[model samples]
Target: MSVKRPNPAQWLWYAVGGKLPDRYREWVLHDATAPTWLVRHVIRRLVFMAPILAALYLVLAVMMNFDLTIVLVGLGLGVYAGMYYSLIFSTHSVDSRVTRHGYPDQYASQVRKALKQAERDRYNATWRNGGATSR
Candidate 1:
């Protein structure tokens, strides 16, 4: 026996309700590759992150005004923020690569290749100029 597929609109509604639309999976997967869909995905992820960050900041600030417990909570939040930012923003970082492109591994490889080519060009230019650099 064969299963009937659900309508695309119904699938979207189900998806919004946190349910997987097995019937429309192929169509959804195909649409995910479109530019508009990709942009929407990025915006959705960022929108989700912003609220959590704001809440964390608010909780930390409120805690800092109280007693020792609050102070400790605030300190923990500060450490978390510092580590998170450092890991996300470090040179040639995975998070940075992902944000610039879409996927981490693919973007990392591309960045590595670009850096290697740039270094090779600089080396060749300096060697041709007898170790003198060009601006």
Candidate 2:
């Protein structure tokens, strides 16, 4: 059986989905010292906000007291701003907290291990197929 090479689009799709390839998934998910409470806190905040924001948007849209186009634009901007803050500020806050206690370095080391394993696998496959030649 031939090994199926990943296409460029597959790599892009993986990036868009915020995932690494299968070989790295295990290592990435392994958290040696994850602060469970912090993770839960962040998750709860996101879960709580999603429905509240949706309900507010729906109520505003239904009221229709303001101009529909303006309301829609404002709603769009609000959602965009919220997501931007979450992605930028919230993530930095979490990372900083994690790093201050050294969780980030552990995570980075795990990721590097996974990447190295992937590279070794690729090299071995190529060598087995006679792609590597001795000088």
**Root-mean-square deviation per candidate:** 12.1, 12.4
lDDT of 2 by residue, 1-135 (tens): 433334556534432333445544332233212335335334534554667667766777776566668777986777677656665554444433334433543453455457778888888889965586787
Clash count, predicted structure 1: 0
Could you give candidate 1's per-residue lDDT for residues 1-135 as a string of tens digits?
A: 444445666644433333344554444333333335435444434443555656765665564445656656765676567556644543334333243333444454455456668888898877965686569
- Candidate 2, superposed: residue stretches over 4 Å from native: 1-49, 89-135
Best by lDDT: 2
Error at 112, model 1, angstroms: 3.1
The residue ranges of model 1 lying beyond 4 angstroms of the native Cα positions read 1-50, 57-65, 68-105, 127-135
lDDT of model 1, residue 129: 51
**Winning candidate number (TM-score):** 2
